[model samples]
Target: MSGRWWLLPGTLCTAEVFEPLLGALAVSPQQCRSVRLDRPAVEDYAAELASVEDEDIVLGFSLGAILAAHHLDRMRALAAVLIAANPFADTPEKSAARLEQLARISVEGPGAVMAAAWPALVGPDARENPAVGNRIVAMAEQTVQDLPAQTELALRRPGAEPMLASARSRALFITGREDPAAPPDRAMRAAAIGRHELVLVDGAGHFLPLEAPRACAEAIRAFLLGRGQDRS
Candidate 1:
C-alpha cells in the first residue's frame, strides 16, 4: 500500500511554499498533501491537523513544527517531522527576541520586516541564484501581510518541550546546517529530548524546503520508508 504524507507550512506561509519540495517528491509512491493554516495560533493549526481522519506522516516546517509539537498527542499520524523549527523549552531571551521582532514589524511594516528577515531565511546560495532568490522574495512579499498577527501568535505559543518528550509518535527533526533562525545545534538538542533523529542539509538555510528541496525530499522519503518498513 502507498504511504500518505501531510505537509504543514511555516508562519505566514501558504502551502505554496512547499511546492518545490512537493514537486520533488512527486515521483515517490507516497501520496503527499500540504495543509494550509489560515489561522495564526499554534493551537488553531494543531486543531485543524488533528481533525484529519487518515493515518499519514506529518511534516511541519517552522511554525507548523511548533504546532505539530503542541498537538502530537492528538494527531493520528504514523510519524512526524519538524523542519527548521525550535520546539525546545522556551527561554526569556527567545521571548524577548520575538517581542523585539514584533516591535520592528509594528514600526517598519511587513515588507521591511520581511526584508530584514530574508537574510536569516534563505542561504547564500539561494540568494545568489536569481530564480530561487526571486521566488523566495516573492513568497515573502505575498505572506508578509500576515506577519503581525503571526508574530503575536508565535509569541503566545506554548513551549513544546513537554509534548516533545512525551509524544507517542516517532519524530524526526530536520534543519539546515546554516540556518541561523533555528541552528543545527539547537535543533539537535530539541531532537535529543524525544530521541528523534536530526538531519541537517548542508547548503540550506532556514527555508530548507525551498532552498534544498531535493535534499529535504530524500531525507523525508528515507525516514518515512524506513518507518513504514518497521511497521510492516
Candidate 2:
C-alpha cells in the first residue's frame, strides 16, 4: 500500500535541503515529516522516528539513508528509500580523514566542507553551475551548528551491514553516478549484500536530491508506484 513519507537529511544538512525534492514529489506537507539530525549517534539522532506508524515510508539522504537502513527493524515502517546510501563501516583512513576534516572545518567555519569537498560533492560538469554551487553553499552555512556533532557521529559510526542484511530487504537505494561518497559501483555492491534495489542518477553527484531533484523524484515515484498497490 502507498504510505506517507518521512524525509531525513544527511550530515551538515537541514530540513530545508529537501525542499526541492519535496516539491517534486508533490505531496502535501501534512502527509510528510521533515526530520533533522540533532543527536550525535546513529541511534540517537534517529529518535525523531519514534512517531513513525504502520505502512509508513522512511526516506533518507546520505547519513540519513544509512540511519534508516540500520534502524529499520526498530520501526514499523513498510519500506525505506535510501538515497546516496553507503552503509559500510568507515575505513580507518576515512575516519582519520574525517578527523582532519573536523579540525579543518572547525577553524575554517561551517562552509569549509563545501570548500574541502566541492569537487567530490558536485559532479564535474555541475561544479561550474552557479545555481547548484550557490545553493549548496547556503545549505552549508545554514547547517553550522550540526557540523561538529555530525562529524563525530561519522567517526563513531559502525558498519550498517549487519542491520542492512537483517532488516533492509524493503529498502530502495539510489545514488548519483558521480557521487564519490557513494559511487555507483560501491553502492551497488553494498546493496547487493542486503539484496536491496538501487538506482543510479547519471551525471549527478552526492547531492542528487538538490542537483537533480526532478530526476530523483521520478525515480522515486516509479519505484513506489511499481510496488503493486503502493503508489504514494
- Backbone collisions counted per model: 0, 0
Model 2, 66-178: lDDT tens digits are 77877876777777888888878788887787778767777887676676566668776678777776677777788868877777777777888777777733777878988
Q: Write the per-residue lDDT of candidate 1 for residues 113-219, one digit (tens) a residue.
A: 76556766678888666666556556656776666666666777777877878887778888898898888888887887767777888878998888898987787
Q: Compute the lDDT of residue 69 as modeled in candidate 1.
A: 79
For model 1 the TM-score comes to: 0.83
Clashes of 2: 0
**Model 1 stretches with alpha carbons more than 4 Å out:** 1-4, 27-34, 38-40, 227-232
Who wins the lDDT comparison?
Answer: 2
Q: Which ten residues in a row have the lowest lDDT in candidate 1?
A: 223-232
CA lDDT, every prediction? 0.73, 0.76
lDDT of 2: 0.76
